[model samples]
Each structure stands twice: as C-alpha cells, then as structure tokens.
Target chain A: MTDIALRGVDGLKVDYLALVRRRRLYSALLLVLFVALIAGGFDLADSRNAGGFWSGLSQIFDFPVELVREAINKGAALPGNLWRYLPAMIETINIAAVSTLLGAVLAVFLSLLSTRGLARWPRLMPLFRRVMDTMRAIPEIVIALVLIFVLGGGPVPAMIAIAFHTAGALGKLFSEVNENADLKPIEGLSSVGASWFQRMWLGVLPQVMPNYLSYALLRFEINVRASAILGFVGAGGIGAELRVAISWGTGRYDAAAAIFLLLFLTIVAIDQLSSHVRNRLVGGH
Target chain B: MTTLDAGFDLAAAKRDAERRAFRKRMLTFGIPAAVLAYLVYVAIAFDIAGLAARARMDNARILLADMVSHKVHVTRDNRFDKTTVAIEGENKGTYADDQWPAWVVREGASTVVALEAGNVVRFDPDAVRFDIPDYGVLEIVQNRTGITMTMPAGATPEWINASSSRVTVTRPEGRLTVTKTRAEVFRYFGGWELFFFTLDSPFHGKDWAQLAALAVSGERVRAGESNLAAMASDVWNNAMWRHKDVAWAIFETVLMAFLGTMGAAILAVPLAFAAAKNFAPAFPVRFGMRRVFDFLRGVDGLIWTIILSRAFGPGPLTGSLAILFTDTGTFGKLFSEALENVDRKQIDGLRSTGANVVQRNRFGVIPQLAPVIVSQVLYYLESNMRSATVIGAIVGGGIGLLLTQAIQTQKDWEEVTYYIVLTLMMVSATDMLSGWLRSKLIGGR
Candidate 1:
C-alpha cells in the first residue's frame, strides 16, 4: 500500500509540471504572435500612409508647439476670444442636454415595451428590439448628414440625430436594468387594481430609477463629445467656430486655442461631475 | 394613558407617511416639468420655429429621388451638332457609339428616346420635339440667336416651362430641355446605373448565369487573363465607382481601429498599475499617473485629430494615433479601477505559496481581472470602429472621407446612400462580433 501511494505521488508531480510547461509554452506562443501582428500591421499602415511613421514621429509636436507659441503671443486676446465663443459652446451643451432628455424619455417607453417578462405586448417585443438594433447600427453622422441635407444644418439636426442614437443605446441598457428589477412590487400593484401605467410608474420605475439615472449621466458625457463632433461636421456650435478659426490660419490660432481650452475644460469638468454623481447613485457611497 | 400614547404615535407615523407620499408625487411631476421648461428654452435658443423656413425640402426631394433612380442624358451639343448618351451625365458612364441602351435608337439623323408610357423625344439636327402621351406635340427650334419654342396647343401644362432662352418639358416618363447651346433629354431608370460593371467593361451587360458560365469556362474575356479574373479586375478598377479605392479605405478604417485600440490597451496596463493604489504604494506617482490619464481624455478626439493630422499630414496614421491617444486615458482609468477591485485573498493565497510580486499579480490578480480586461477591450473595439469613421473624416483617411466628399458634392446622393449603408453594416458587424467574443470569453450574464 505504501509503495503504491509513493508511485501515485510521483506521477502527480510529473503531471503537474507538464501542465505548467504546456501553459507557459502556449502563453509564450500567444505573446510572440501578438507582437508579430502588431509589428506587421504597423508596417502595412506606414507603407499605406501618406507620410511614413518614422518621418512623422519627430514632427508630432511641431503643430502643438506652434499652437502654444501663437497662443502665448496673443495672450491678451484669449479671454475675449473665449467670451466670443461662449454662445456656440452653450449651443453644444444644449444639444447634448436636450438630446439626452428626449432620448431617455423615449428609452423609458421603448425599454418597458421590450423588456422580456415585463413587456406589455409580449408578441411585439422582438419587433421593438429589432427597431432599436437598427437605430443603433446607424452611425450618428449618417443621420446627421441626411437631416442636414433635408432640414439644413443646425443644432436641431444634431440634436435629432444624437437623440435617435441615444434612444437605441439607452434602451438596451435600461432594459438590462429592468430585467434585474424585482417583479413582486409590480405584481402587488397589479393585484390591487392598478393599471399598467400605474404598475410600471409606481413599482418598476422606482426600483430602476437610480441605475437609469447613472447610465443617463454617462450617456450625457458621451453625447457632449458627440455633439461637439457633429458640430465639426457642420451641425453648428464651437466646432464650427473652431473650424473657422483653424482655417483662417497663422494669425487666428489664438481663437482656435481659446476654443480648444473651452472644450478641454468643459469635458474635464463634466467627466469629474458625472463620475462623482454616478458613484453616489450606483455605489451608494 | 399608555393606549392613548400608542394611538398618538400611530397618528404621527401616518402623517409622516402622507408627507413622504406627497414629496414623491411632487418629484414624479416636477422632473418632467423641469425637463419641459428646459426644452422650451432650447426650442427658442435653437430657433426651432425658424427651421421650417430654413429647411430645403427641394434638396430632400432630390436626395430621395437620386437614391433610387438614375437618369440617362441624351445630349445634343448644338455648337458642333454632336450627340452623346451618358448615364448621370458622367463622362465615365458615356455609352460607346454602338452600345447605347435598347430604349434609345438612332433613325437617320435623329436620335429617338422611347420614354415610359409611349412618350417619345427626338433630338434632330436643328430641332427638338417631344410627344407626350396625353398632351399634344411640343416642338422647339434652336437658332444661333436663341431658342424658339412652340408649346402644345391649348393651355400649356404646368410641368412644361418655356422661355425665349430655354424651354423645359417634364413628365413622369422623362424630361426634355432645349437651349440655344444644346438640347437634352433625360430618361429615368429604376436602378443604379453601372453599379456592378461600367459600360466600358466587356462583362457589363452579362446576366448572372452568363457570368457564372464564363467564370468557369476556359475562355478569356481579356487576353492573358481568365474570364473570372478579368471580370473581377474590371469591377475592382471600375472608373465610375472606384471600388478598389473604397475597399482600401474600409481596410484602412479597420486598421486604424485595431491598431489604436490594441496599442492603447497595451500601453494602458503598465500605467494602470502605476495609478492603482494597491500597486503603486506612492501617492504622488499614483496621483500624477491618474492626472495624466485625465488630461489625455479631457483633450477630446477632435482636438487630437486636428493636432495629429497637422503633424502627420492627413492619413490613417494620424487617425490611428488620435484614437490611441484618447483611448489610452480611458483604458488606463478603467484598468486601474479593475486592479484596485481585485480580490486580495487571491494575492494572499499566492503569497502563502511563496510567490513573488510578479507571480502574485500574474496568477492572482490577472486571473481575476482578465474577464474585465477582455470584455472592456472588445467593447471599445466595437465603439472605436465608429470613432475611427469620424476620426477618418477629420484626418482625411477612410470611408468617412469618401462619405463626406460624396455628400459635399451635393449631386452624389446615390454614392452617399451607398456609403451610409456600408457604414451601418460595418458597425453592426463589429457590434455583433464584440458581443460574441464577450459572451464566449466571459460567459454570458
């Protein structure tokens, strides 16, 4: 019996070592392959690019340096330029805000109608889900550009485009939250003769409201960035102003600098604020 | 006396519940009201009321029409009295002398277009004539001075507009225009013209069955090349659409996303370790790394694209670098949080086995964090595909450049629609791909 046990122990040790060696070999192979892929892809991209990577590497800082030097030279005019662009910046924020609100409202209805167990019309749930999928699939720029052609370029076009996308994204998230919500309150509300709207409003919404708010805040952060980008594409905001300033070239970079400063500061401020609020809402800390 | 106190307590509790219910009711109504008030302000600020006047419904009509239809222009240059037929009036789509569409034919010196519903238009040497199905004959005579038009007898239809310098006749079947310099007729077609193959290609008019047969046969459509190869090369190098360039552009877009996302993830892991409180053990180092990440993120992609494009001179490289710069910050922040949240017990267990710091992290921490890292990276891969498109536009690199150029041309609505559809498909594909990977790697929740 003792000899058999010793042999079994020795066999176990050998097997364990072999397993470790195999894992190491596999991981080493994966690492090598990954490195090779990165190198090869970089070469391909460099060859295809208008400028080679090595040649452009040193010049990467030249533009920023020039921008900084010009801004410093025109320091006295910076504040005035920033002030001048405040309205456009406001338009950017308003576009984000309006779209978020409109999208969240729409998502509330769509998510409720599409959530698996809680769907009002279970038979049509797949159709609503597909509708959201299609909406989400389309890039905001496509819709924005189309609307710009039809409605002409403005904040409204950007707002509508972003809202359309936001509805799809938030609807998916909101339904996820809804699926995890406790159904007991809903059932109790319904048994007491509450209508469908009342059951959802008084029961399911309260449970999911915090998470919904958290996701909405995050969406707001993303939408702010999106709105700015759409503006650059001619939706009308600081982006348009930045485009104009940049196109004016050498002497007008100070305006461009001011816009950049505004955009950076706004993004940072919103990021910090939303992260704080989200932590409080979701983490309960 | 005790019972009375109990009753009083119950009453107080009841009053408290009523107050709480009242607050909830107010909140339910108050939030949406505030939202409504804000929207009203936005409507005023955005000038929604004036949008109607600013909108170009005519542009919409043209865009919708162009998306699904093509027009064949049968143009007669009166200066030289030379006639040509082209699709969409593009020189690339011009038909050869003998390759004109079956609906158009030349009889003697006149070119006759058989428009839909028996409407016929003839472009003759000194005159243009249109016979509408219901309306009487409309004729125009062009001289060196100007155009002379004789409208159909009786009241002229609203669709037909005539002047001394120009005359245009419009019907559901086709359109006719007469000017001193030229006379043209446009016949509408239901589908995209020359989408798969241009008129110049020998394979242009072949049906699918014929193409399939030719593809397998030993015959060579062009000398020194197989029929299949020649057909493919023709489509790829198509002058009208530039399919080869478009395919390259899409490839560039994907390359940008892949390189940027993977590069960011790689660079982020070490920086994340430096930022994580449990790993760095130095306040200043952690704080500095965190701030660096914040700075990278705060400088949005648009600004980065501009700065990078100026340095790199407009290409996929600039777009890729822009994404890399922005995503490094996001990934760093997320990775550090995941590191901080790692199960300390696992590290302790590894330590009991005499594992070093590196091994402890490798076996203990990473095993716990791998799921998160993989899922987050894949999610970004999908979203970065989208960002790459927008970045591509700003940097003048990929399909976004093609799309923007098409839209800017204002007359390439068909091309714009094509790009939009392709972009949608690409994004949806990435979304599905990432979701599949996430489910496979992390186990679906």
Candidate 2:
C-alpha cells in the first residue's frame, strides 16, 4: 500500500515470489549438481576397490535381466523368477493390511483413553497419553526386531510391529479428530443418560470414520513397501529377496532392480487409489 | 397394539441397561487387564521402568563382568578382526596344519574340565591334561555336550564378585580339570550372549583381535568373511565404516526428505492461504494441502523408498527423494493446519483498511508462521531421522546398510551393537538440537 509501484486489481494485490522466478535456473543447477555428485561417488568408489564399484553398480542394472532371463528360458520356464517372488510380495502387502486393521481396532480403544474429547479422568488421561507418547517414541523397526524372536522371522512379526506403532500414530490422530468433533451431539446424548460407549459409537464414529479410513489406508500402503525390506531378517518379502540377491556371488543385481520396479508401480497404484477414495469422502462434505 | 408397544419399550430399556453395565466394567477391568499384559511384556524385556522414565546409563555392572570373562580374549581383540576355528581330530582324515588352529594329540592326553567358573577341581594325577587357552566357552560347549568321565563328581560352584577381588560363594563345587592350555581356551571364550558373530565390536584392547590380524592379513579379510575378528573389526572400525559407499546413500536420504518436505512447505503456503477463512476462504486450496499431508504421511516411508528405488534404482538418491516427496505431503498438512489455526485478528485489521490479500499475508502471515514453520521443520528433521533409518534399510541407505551386511555375513554382534548405538546417538542429537532451535525461535516464551 505504501509503494506506488505496487498496484491493486480486483481487490487483490499481486506480489512476486522469489522462488518461482528462479525455478528454471534452480532446477537446472539441481540436476547438474545431483549428477556430478553421483558420478564422483561412483568414480571414487571404483578407484578404491578395483572392481567393487562396477560390480556393485552392475548388480543394480546388469545381472538379473541377463542371468535370470537365461535361467528361466533354458530350464526354469519362468521369467525373472516371478513364480517364486509373487507370493512374498503379496504377503508383504498383507502384513501392512492386517497391521493397519489391528491398529485401527486398538486406536478405537485408545481414543477413549485420550483427552482430545472427553474430560473423563483427566489425571489418568495424561498418564495414558504419556504412555501413548512413549509407545510412539520407539521406532517401528525396533518393535519388529524384538517381536521377530517371539513371532519368528516372517510377516506375522512385522504385522505385530506395524500394528503397535500405527496404534500410537492413529490413536493420536483419532483423539485430535474427536476433540474437534461437533460436541453438541455428544453432550445431548450424554445428558439423556446415554452410556459413554453408546455416545462414542453414535456421535464420535460417524464424524471420525473418514479419518480412520484415511489413516488405515495410508498405513497399509506403507506396510506394503516396508515388507519388501523387512525380509532381510528372514522376514521374507521383496526386500528380503533384494538383500539375498545383493549377497550372492558375482553379479545378480538386475533381478533386484526388476522387482523394485514392480514394487514401485504397486505403490503408485495404491497412492492413486487412496487419493481417489480420500477425495471422494472428504470432498462430498 | 398398546400391549405390544409397552413390551417393546421394556425390552429396549433392559437391553440399554445391560450395555451400559458392560461398558462400565470394560473400562474398569479391560483397560487394567491390557495394562497387566503390557507389564508382563516389559518385565520380560528387562526394560519395564524405562518405558515411563528416561534411561539411565547402567553399563558399569556389565563392564565389570566383561573384564573377568574377557580377560585374555578381550586383550587380543584390540588389533584386528578375524574368527578362529578349533580342530581336534588329526588322524580322522582332517588336515593337521599349524596354519589351521586345531589340536591333535594322543587320546590319553585329553582332559575334562569344569563348565562354570570358580569351581574346585578334583583331578586324578593319572588323567591326561591338555592345554588350550584360546577357545571360548561356547566352543567348550561345542566340544563337550555329553561325555562319560571316569573322574568323581565335582564340587558345587561358588559365587563371587565378578572382579573376584571380593570372592563371594555360598557353596563351592569340584572342578573338572583339563590341562592349563585347555582351561585357558575355555576361560577365553565364555561369558557372552546370543548371536556371538554380530559385527558390534568395541575396540578396547582385546587379545583375540591381535591374533586375528596376524593370521588373516591384507586381501583375505574382505572376502565376505564370517568369523569373530570380522565382527570385532566391524565394531572397532564403525566410524571409518561410515565413509564407505553406504555413507553417501545416507546423506542422500537426509537431503531428499528435507528438500522434498521443503518443497511441500513452499506449495503449502499458497494453498493454505487460499483455504484459510481470513484469506481466500475458498474450498480448493485450503483443503487441498490439508489433505496432502494425510495422503503423504499416511503411506509408509518404506513404501516410498521401494517406489523411488524402483523408479530411480537403488541408491541414496532414490531413497532420499522418496523421503522428500512423502515428507513434503506430510509437512504440507501440518503447515496448512497451522495456518488455519493462526489468529484471524491480524488479517481482519489489515483487510478493514482495504489492504490486498498479498500485502496482508506478507505483514500478517509470514511472521506468525515463521515460528510454526521452524518448529514443524525441526520436528520433521527429527522425525526423518527415523525415516532416514527405514529408508536406508530398504535399499542400501546409511547405517542400515551396515545392519544388512552384518546379518548376511553372520558377523560378530559386538559390531552390530556399535552401529546401532551410533544411529541412536545421531537421532538423539538431532532431536535435542531441534528442541533447542524451537525454544530459541519461540523466544522461550
């Protein structure tokens, strides 16, 4: 308003944002720098290890496409070992799905213990809240590692671990959603001697169902990706296979790369699906 | 009709009462039962109290115990990383070479020994005494699971301070005696936990390490070995290990999450402005970024890592970039939500004077959001410390690469513990620094 150089149009003022004007220049520089850095790293690694860098990089690109393809054609009748691989991939996704489901169930109970809405037992609520905080503080992988011994190295342990962590995460989110809910219905129901559970089921769930789904789906997507790697500890998945390929003698990396593509595409598909569903649910409101 | 309606009403009332009672009991009993279950798990883990309270350093007891059990082996381990195997059968078609660390003698020369420490040995002078001071306790177990010794039953084991300077035992037992060297071997290898071959070595001048370096030198060591010294070396050289190819991937991971999240933050501002009631109050922008976060953070980091690794291939760049996109979506949600929560009075005052939307934001929004943005950024940085960890593991990023390596090789656990500790320190430090920055930005108010 103080500067004449700045003009107003249609009750709106236009201002130049610095980052936008430099987008082209910034992107160009970023690309150049990224490539240079990567090249330099490979060069240095190659120099130091004689053939380690080439062997490693080759594993990323060369082996699987050649050896696995030949192996399948010559004797196995399977291309890229899909027959051996697909089940593990499905199991990985299942680990994420079941974990999310279990977490949702746990979160429902945890929400009741939280202070986001009801002021029931404020003292106990804080203590319980702190407990949730502590649970969240522990990393998911750590949870998985510990549970692995009891559950054995497979999807079950990973599911339990993911569930425990997601409960902490979803429980916190649920409490917040509850606190922001339209409190009128809840209070009215309570005034009429509706029990806490009944009030929650009727007043709270209706408002927060969308939220719960959004979180559960999100957690499921993550589990699908995580299961790929969780298998290195004998958990069994794409990641476990990837690790096995890396550990194999000579060069067998292309197989890992090929499978990684499938895993990535699956994630993209899941991402699109979740986005579509979330848009429909929240937008209709 | 009146009678039927009355009966229906009575039934409904009765059902409602039963439900209420069930719920009340659930809260009273169910919650406590769950707590009981959690406590049992905690007790088993030896980490029961650390759940609610901060962890205290209590390695003094562990360190003391280690010194006694470790005595000579710990000293030899200070130099190099290698593993040792003992061979007892010489004439059984097994190659008897000095280069091979094995024992071969007449059958009469072999002697029995006590498994537990500080037990009295009732030795017959007639028995052969073999000397083997280099083997560990587990190796001793490997050697002797079941044997019928003609010697008399040994006395009970006595309790004592680990240092043995203050020996304390209630009842002493007889010791099965082996030769001096054999006794030395058993003494060297015992007193540890599961997974003895993890790469979590602590280079505190141990004896076994020196011997390993001498035996396995130069090129032979890096051939993907599975032995004790390798495990010890992994722990001892962890800091140096950070320099290997894995380190670059880790840096890439951090850069990717931070930069990508920053990108989301940038986009979030305009959308957040549009969605806010004090500003655009429009349906499209405010809600878009708000949902972006739920979409981004909802999916797991592992998902992004796998996806990006596929799209880009396995490297720090893929992992990092995946983290970037995922984190941005999350940061956008948190940022936009924070924007929505901003005090409306500032915008209202500017608007009343006919100030334009752009001007209002500059003067009103940026300053208020600065603290929130910084705080949120710091929180993401801390949160991503863990995310970075998961990303690393997915492919070959950061310390996670080391973890995968250790597992595959069946390396010593001492090194594995070291890398894990290093990771914990890194995260803790980041968390602390973020907290400090947050307080400073908020002016400690």
The model with the greatest DockQ is: 1
Pairs of residues at least 3 apart in sequence or in different chains that clash in candidate 1: none
User: Candidate 1: misplaced stretches above 4 Å?
Assistant: A1-8, A248-251, B1-22, B136-170, B177-180
Instruction: Encode model 2's per-residue lDDT on A171-195: one tens digit a residue.
Output: 8777877777888888999999998
Per model, how much of the real contact set is kept?
0.65, 0.05
Lowest lDDT sum, 10 consecutive residues, model 1 chain A, at A244-253
Per-residue CA lDDT of model 2 for B1-445, tens digit only, reads 3455644687778899999999998987996688567546534433334422432222223223332332111001112321122211112212222333122112232323332343322122232222222311211111222222231234322321112111111221211222222222222333432222212233223466664764466444445764445655565344423433444544554554454455445556665565555555566665675565555655446545544454455555555556666766666655666777888788889889999978888777788888888877777777676666666666565656565565344323344444555565666667668788788878772
Evaluate residue B111 in candidate 2 and report its C-alpha lDDT on the 0 to 100 scale.
25
Tell me the docking grade of candidate 2. incorrect
Error of 2 at B365 (Å): 11
TM-score of candidate 2 against the unseen true structure: 0.51
* lDDT, residue B437, candidate 2: 76
Question: What's the TM-score of chain A alone for every prediction?
Answer: 0.92, 0.71
